[model samples]
Target: MPIPRIHEIMEADQRILNAFSPEKLHRLGQAIGLNDSTTVLDLACGKAEMLATWARDYGISGLGVDFSEVFVADARDRVRELGVADRITIEYGDARNFSPRQRFDVACCIGATWIGNGVEGTIELLRQSVTTQGLMLIGEPFWRKAPTAEESVEMGFSADEFSSSLHELVARFTACDLDVVEMFISSEDDWDRYVAPKWLTMRRWLEDNPHDPMFDEVRAELTNSQLSYTRYQRDMLGWGIFGLLER
Candidate 1:
């Protein structure tokens, strides 16, 4: 199954696709000190919810780049619905190859760091798009408690897939010449909000598209996700959005 199609089915009802709430997202924008003059560059911006909401609330202008045709369309619609079309631009393309003519005041790679390979490389990528001392917002996952090799394998993750702890995650930023100014750690409630909705969405999709080519795969994926969430993810996994200032 196509990755984008899988995401489309799972997150059909979600706007901010990461394990974040609208309130927390807005608080993050405030913590970062957004204003009318702020220029932002959002990479892998699913639905562009952060940009759209910030534009409405803070009057910030920005560009959002995404690869998912489904998400790009929804993002465009979201901007228009929010009446921030004049402040936000949604671009459809590979974020890894995006080259901005002018650096932005903020650069974000929320929940989609694979565009630059991983955390370290992603920090480097975002750095190139922002002005000196600009902020970089990175949404990353970490281990709440270290899992054994067996558990890691069962989670379909490599040994180095995530930072060992939240402190380690901050250290990774410092190693790249960035300062962790602030962070918003997702609570278990946030995790539930992000994961539970997918079950219903996937089930409904399966019911309506029994004859679809990707039906079986989607069902199996959904089953695995439910099992994994119950068995390991809920307690062992954690996610956070870190605000980093270039040093």
Candidate 2:
């Protein structure tokens, strides 16, 4: 099975596949100063919602790269639906191997830094595709409160998967010689919006695909996810998008 298949199932009905609302995304677009002249490169851009919306609202043009065929198809459809097909290109490929012909005004890898391994590595990856005067946007999770090793395991991640705190996350940017210029921290409501919808989707999928080979896997995942979210992630974890400028 494709690595993204599980994610595709979990986020089947989602457009923006992260802990962000449309209003917050729009606010972030505005905060980033997007314009008709700004060109963006979005790596691991799920469904290209940000690109399509920014194109329609801010008149920006962009290219989005993703690993999921399903997401790429949806992204293309989204641009057309938004009447911004002329302003955006969605490519289905490994984002890490995407070497753009020209550097972009903004390089973003929201909620998918794993494409470059981690925060520091992802910064180095984005730096290659952004102009010196441009900005890079990264969305990452941090620990709201330090997690016990057992809690981290229950939350479905290794103990060190996230930074110790939001402050530590920002410090990682500084260590990479970049400055955090602006940020959007996810509220509990945002987390609820991102995670809670998966249960309904998974439950429906279970009802519809009773005999599929992955049925049991999905069922187990859904149960574990619910438990993890309630007992650990909701209070112990935080997510945010940070805008970074070169120092």
Candidate 3:
């Protein structure tokens, strides 16, 4: 089966596809204590918002890799818009095949660990790209509470899919041989920002492309996504971008 590219529906205009508020995103950057000497390796970087923002705000340099042609193009344009083109490189390719071209001060798999199949594998991928003292940032979702057996099977997610709690999530990191240094957890408001705009984007696209072949598919995706989010994700899911180090 083909994978659904969620970001494709989420809209190209969006710089950050993750449930991160501008405040929270800035805080994530702050956790790194970004400086001019910093460099980053962002795998599965959707539109490279964090890297672009860091470049503009901290004068850091980095390479962002993602398989989405549209997203990679947008990321390039974003850095150009921020006048940091020289400091940022956006590559369009399969993140699973992406090897570290150079060592980085920070290597991130954020929000797209599925590229490496799961968190532990993704951490290993990031680990290969990071310098000795480099930070590894992984963005993952934890269950705020365990879903009942009934709720588990909804929206193609089983209760078993999530870490039982935050404690287990941290344990997963330790099992991967990484130290949990710091983290920036997303608030409901941040998730709201990430999701609400996509609704508007989908609605607008549907309005403009009523006769298009994808109308039905897009409509169904919009409906199902909205339903799944409101019914299960918002209340049951918690997300965090954790900073890690080799143990």
Candidate 4:
């Protein structure tokens, strides 16, 4: 069986994804010049929060694609609940190879660039979804400063794989012929919002499945991550939502 996803354990608390406030999303929309008729493709869209927000707030029509069946169903339910089912469609598919019949005015890959293997590769992948003069939004992690090799390894990055500085990140976009249009940086609070709840959810799951052998591995991984995060990443790294346009 495939390893269980973190979301599988905390499916009950959908609010955890609300780390990006509506206001922040609206600001991102404005930065990207979203409109009532904009067609967006959300790559690796988890629960379709960004898609739902855009449909409701900006009147943009879009499709959200994700690999998780549970997340796709949740996103579909959210679209129905918001009464914007007509504006947003949710699909279960891999973002790396999804191809839509229609092109999009905007394409987004938020915090899941692994779909493209890496930053430059993700930009290339998103370009296939965009129409002429369209916007591409990439949410990525960057170091606030150079991290020690030890710090990189502690943060789950290979010594050679971690980005050394923010400039390197921007350089990758520039090299891909993508212009940096706007960005929203995530604060420490945002990281907390995304990660802290995992602990509680995992603890509850462990209580309910005390005899499950996998829980031991999950517990150990979570504990190590929690301690390492507090010790190393809390103030060391940063993430941002970047809006890029074709040069």
User: Which candidate achieves the best lDDT against the true structure?
Assistant: 2
- Distance (Å) between predicted and true CA of 164, model 2? 0.6
Overall local distance difference test of candidate 1: 0.92
Off by over 4 Å in 1: 1-3
- Residues 23-137 of candidate 2 have per-residue lDDT tens digits of 9999999998999999999999999999999999999999999988999999999999999999999988898777878999999999999988899989989989999899999
Candidate 3 per-residue lDDT, tens place, 8-99, comes to: 86575587888887677777787779888899999989899999999998889999988888888789989999999999999888888887
C-alpha positional error of residue 215 in candidate 3 after TM-score superposition, expressed in Å: 1.4
Kindly list the per-residue Cα lDDT of model 4 for residues 70-104, writing each as its tens digit.
Answer: 77878998889888999899988888888768889
Model 3 residue 100 CA deviation in Å: 1.6
* TM-score per model over all chains: 0.97, 0.98, 0.95, 0.91
Clashing pairs in 4: none
Measure candidate 3: CA RMSD. 1.6
Angstrom error of the Cα, residue 117, model 3: value is 0.7
Query: Once superposed on the true structure, which residue ranges of model 4 sit more than 4 Å away at CA?
Result: 1-4, 10-12, 15-19
Each model's lDDT: 0.92, 0.92, 0.86, 0.80
Model 2 accuracy (lDDT, Cα): 0.92
For candidate 4, give the lDDT: 0.80
TM-score of 4: 0.91
